[model samples]
Target: MTLPADITERLARLALPSQAVIDGAHVDALSGETFDNVSPRDGQLLNKVAACQKEDVALAVFAARTAFEDGRWRDQGPRAKKAVLFRLAELMERDADELALLESLDVGKPISDARNVDIPLAINTCRWYAEALDKVYGEVGASPVDRLSYAVHEPLGVIGAIVPWNFPLHMAMWKVAPALAMGNSVVLKPAEESPLTALKLGALALEAGLPAGVLNVVPGFGAVTGEALALSMDVDMIAFTGSGPVGRKLMEYSARSNLKRISLELGGKSPQIVFADCPDLEAAAQAAAWGVFYNQGEVCTAASRLLVEASIKEAFVERVAEVAKGMKVGDPLDPSTQFGAMVSERQMNTALGYIAIAGSQGARRVLGGGQVLKETGGFYVEPTIFDRLQPSHALAREEVFGPVLGVMSFTTEDEAIALANDTVYGLAAGLWTSDVNRALRGARRLKAGLVWVNGWDACDITMPFGGFKQSGFGRDRSLHALHKYADLKSVSVTLR
Candidate 1:
């Protein structure tokens, strides 16, 4: 396995912490089990992490529960909690470079993206939620004659957050920042495949003045630690980000065990529409390339389905093909690389299987379609584009979570809307058009949770983010996310 020149330098500069830290103490797993953190870039062991089990999950949850029920975290006033969160955000900014490096290595995202985009966005998300914490207003309702009604928001006890391997550290911050700011202790279960940065985050929280047990992380397999957290009766809520099937299972488990509040952010096959009225075809083509190819197209809101108007479909696709041909896919730690390897060998295999299935389903590969640079020992796939896909085709319907774009043409606005909303998942969609009326109409008609006009995947921390249908429910990042972690209580007063 040959390491990319840039990765070799980055790895040499990385500073890794020892495996265990719990309640301000360094220790191993309860059973002394350890797991290796492997680099997807070269299939080499990076470090050892505590191989947390069901018992470890129980311990972490118990710590969180104790902290929420009897510790300083729950006792801290909202202002104080907000202050701590702000400080944590500042600390994140201070360590941004190291954090970005860790995220790129653990999750296989481009180094440039992790440094310039994901980490900064994550820090802002925490800072934004922190600022919003003290400003959240309770509601007052008018009552008849002598009575008054008012509502007060209070935190749920302990929140169990299960984050996916893709964007591990950022997703963890998405859940933890708001939950803790709202006075809820959190038991975070980062995906086992990319758990290094998450474990590191736990220690950083402590350094940033978070009390012991207020934020606990257990890194392990889903079947054991993940399931335990979902099924724990003591847990007040579960916030999960992953596939639809796993989210459904978490919902079931939450329902069965004390009826915990569950917030699910699942998969998407988001559509990016380019109409005939688009002002600049070249600009739209570049945006389309970044929309689907960034992070190797593993983003839940990635525009996997490109719905081009028949008038300009051929030209636009040709431009996109040219851009796709130049995407550099290699080690994530490389600052110059645009596309990185998939998160793991299993994910790589899954992506290849999807491509094979698309070929069997009569879809024609227009450009780069198979494995690339196989000699590198890294799991890399070509940035593939498949054209002539029917609305019902599997390639068009399913979330590939790879750099595989499915292109289909529509003739009318109605046809475009139909093609966009045909999928069961409704996370996000994009429309490129110069017509004001068309943009407004498409925004209104699209079934997605978020609509991007003339661009794709443009996100802000202040805006609420979630999905409409099977893509799962509940918003993250914004003040809307804080509501899920809080419970509303009404107070009625009688005035004579």
Candidate 2:
């Protein structure tokens, strides 16, 4: 696994964003405090990042409010806002390689994925929203003959956007792009584990000619900076992507403050079902195996649960296990590496702990078990798969958020749907079958926000992304996402 010379050179001179970006400028925390940003890849010191606390959040919120109220951005002509967003997208494209490297290093994800998927998608998302800014139209409602009624979409000002470590810049853009496109000011709080990309994005937004105080970046732990942003009375909305506990806390914080609108994209323990009549067994096997192992299974919609028909259970698991065994688990910076380190040693331990609990809960390990590549000082785990587990098993119910897959067999379509919907999460699910009737029926019966008939994660940015039930609410992609950052105002004019 040779590192690219370009990547090597960039790594040698990596300059991390060590301060929060507020009012379109980089600044230290009001308390001048900082924390170590250690690389999970090798436990090396990446940099010392500013630890923004309550006061820093207050400053960011005030800045955002001022920008929103004064119409610095909110009152911009649609085309003007579009031009700035388009410029930001162009800048992201210009620095694509650098952004990819930052994400790969910060999140311990494969460089190939960062370069090919995350950063590119983030840039596309920005461009997509920029192109959409001038295209969105309001509606005219029918009213009595004496009056004319129309509804207009207004920007929800002062958004507190909190993104997770797994996707980092991608998730931030999911919120920021839409919020900014709608002419709202934003205070972005990147996950403490991964903040470099968000800070850089803020800088790029300013470089793209966005007004000062339109977008602010605060990097720190969730307890202080995140909570402060969530509890800010001035903030109009909170668009968050993370865990259920944190989402609930955000709601509570909103309740305690301004009753700000909360849009949550909590992680999910999704399922992938395979019937014996699958169109392509090999493809299904690949989907089941890689879907769970990709990004070290850090994805919120990871298909961690694989439901196979009873008749094909044994053979399918073998096929999936072979795919899992072939995964190249190594340094994320290496081009050929498919599986990378966990975001931190703590996350690695969490996966290991879940594996231990799965063993105790009567699940038989089919492939992979413990940590690997320990000599490299990185937190790498083998792609693990477990079968012979009941739906009641803890591994089957919980989100391990690691390179671990649990297998179960269902004799009937009814049972498969039942098992798939048993979890508290309803983010995404998939099924493979040649029978269109069963596929359609199962898709309808399955409880999830997004469902794929013959593939895993088959959709793109054009589709709405989010979850149902306890997995949380609020769509994050497509034209629907812009609605999250807007308010509907109805007006009626009486005819003379």
Candidate 3:
């Protein structure tokens, strides 16, 4: 299909730097290995990035260790760190549009979303953690006679972060911001599918006054570079955002080594519950559509499971169907597009396979059961909806991580709560109701870490974000996230 005028302009305007930056120098991979970044929209080659390897990961970790031990970054006080972070936020804001375009091209998310939602939130995350660094308080205890006792927070040096492809830049910021704010250096490995923006951010961080070797970005395959980072004995902590199986492996590797401090934010199949008494059915329907379809429904907190009260199930399903039907799925750079292509050909095939499974399992297809606008050559799946699904159905239990929703009905409050908690993953859940008592009960009873009342997928930088159960542990945002990168030590001194 012909590209839209706006998309064409944006694509032509994007300028990718020729080399990857490492240790204050722009360089190529050690083996001269390279990988092509393809746009999901038309399978077009966007750019060629250095294909980093295990040796590269080791180099990155060593650089970070040196930065933490011998570099100026570790010697800077909390106030100085905050100032550097603030400057980083400013630089991010300045390059927002360019980064947004890169993110949209690399990940197949709408340019508008990359600009207005993802990039801004990422910058604000750094700014928020910057302000909180100096405010984190430690404990002081009463001592025995002629003794003084106090506690201090210290950084866990040389953190290793592995981020997924769906929101590459944003997830990188989520990991890097707090770790740097707490005085720890980082070695970041971006998913191979979407690594351009992360590499760009590495350069931008240097421009923002972050010292060289303090932050390193390596783009490579998971089995090679990613595994090396997780298994490295020199790395102090491992913070990862990815699938459950990989998270389990990371845990095992950490255990085998130094039992490194690990923080994982994994997959989810979150539920969006709509009660009969919801005051605004239209608003709930729209929120549900956006929650499930945004970024091609690749979000960890995507409301893939919709649990509606029996009385309102029919109407709510119809309303959501209407909204889904109206969404525009095409080129991501188009300003008018609401949805975009899936991240890659592999993800497209995976989503289609899930749809087939849903069909064979006897879930009724309410709307959008197939691909749309195939002439574009883009890996685009229709916004799909499956209704009358059983609680044990594969579609209901697993995270499709695509633009697909499974609808189920519940009779009572207990049933709704049970259905919501039925999944192994519990990253987030949404509750829409007019009754205050029911809302309160749902909020308390839901097993997920984040609960939205009368809305879905609405997040702020100040709120804590993580999951329970197989969805992984440890939070990402908020002041509490800073604690994940820090260690507490208590000291007692005798003064006679």
Candidate 4:
């Protein structure tokens, strides 16, 4: 896993955000423990990051609780919170390059994608909540003129946000922005695989004039640090984005602790259906190719299943195969690289194992079915695709969470919807059709939280993002997110 001379030099000069941020300062783990953060680019050691555990979580929760109870943040007027958040957004924009670099190095995403997509989106999220903080309005209950009854939204106090590694900073902001904008303190427990930006974000929060203990970051394994946060009684709410098992565990922990509110955004085995009368076959083919393959297919709402009409299935598959083949998979640091390595060797192995399982189950792999760039000792997987995959097959049913897509053919629209809804996931789905009636029908009939017609992943931060059914409850973005972070209380007053 060797890097080029320039990249090596740049990495050496780059300051890794390795320490945990607690009470507005960077500190080593109380246990003095550290873990090796290896680069997926070349399997090389990037740095030894603080392995914050239960003790760290306690400290962070205490900080968050103190800030909440003391009214250091929760009592701040909306304008104060807005100013702090706006400054934080400015800081993020200022450090965009370094943030993008840390994201790429830590998450194995391309630098360009980090800079163009994740970083900008995170900044926008911060600004969006900041700009909208003062605009949030409460309700007025209908009552007699002699009496007044009104409901006001109040902060939920200490919030524990546990975000995943795939898009660490971006996902963290999705929870952090609104939580903070609602005048609540936050304890951020970032995924172990990519903790750099979260740690940096905590520091940036302090720099943005957020009161001490308003934002704290602890980085460690899920079993240790994450468990502590979930089980903490001081936490008022747990906003989590990860796997289903973890989400269930969070719920159990919530009940076992203070019955604190828990919100989860989990996995999806989203299907992209294309009718024979698709308005643009080429456009649909491109969407099918990038929807699952982008971000190494680590997205929870990735269109992992392609359900197409039998008449154009072969042609559509060929176009997708061409796009996958042409995509360059190499170093994440390279701006030109379209695809990058897996976040870890373990993830690469999981994807490969899934590919093998699909083959054994009789699914035909139309494109890449194995690993590439093995000589570099890096974790890399070629964009893989399977054809004519049966709906009951494991590839089509399970969430691979990788760059592997299973294409299934359908004769009718009803069959396509059935094939799409057969899975346990109901996160997101997409359909491409030229018929306006069919488009409306499919968009309504699809069993998903978000459905895109004639496109894939076409929505943005302006829309609510989450899943239905087993994909977990609660949402991450849009104005709905603000309501999730606050509690409504009705006050009645009588005037003489």
**Alpha-carbon local distance difference test for all models:** 0.86, 0.93, 0.89, 0.92
Which 10 successive residues of model 3 have the least lDDT summed? Answer: 17-26
Question: What TM-score does candidate 2 reach?
Answer: 0.99
Give the TM-score of each candidate: 0.96, 0.99, 0.97, 0.98
* Highest-scoring model, TM-score: 2
Global CA lDDT computed for model 4:
0.92
Against the true structure, what is every candidate's RMSD? 1.8, 1.0, 1.4, 1.3
Candidate 3 regions exceeding 4 Å error are 1-10
Positional deviation of 349 in candidate 1, in angstroms? 1.0
Candidate that beats the other on lDDT, 2 or 3, i.e. the better one: 2
TM-score: the better of candidates 1 and 2 = 2
Better of 1 and 2 by lDDT: 2
The sequence of per-residue lDDT tens digits that candidate 2 reaches over residues 159-226 is: 99999999999999999999999999999999999999999999899999999999999999999999
Candidate 1 stretches greater than 4 Å from native = 1-10, 17-21
Ranking by TM-score: 2, 4, 3, 1
Cα error of candidate 4 at position 400, Å: 0.9
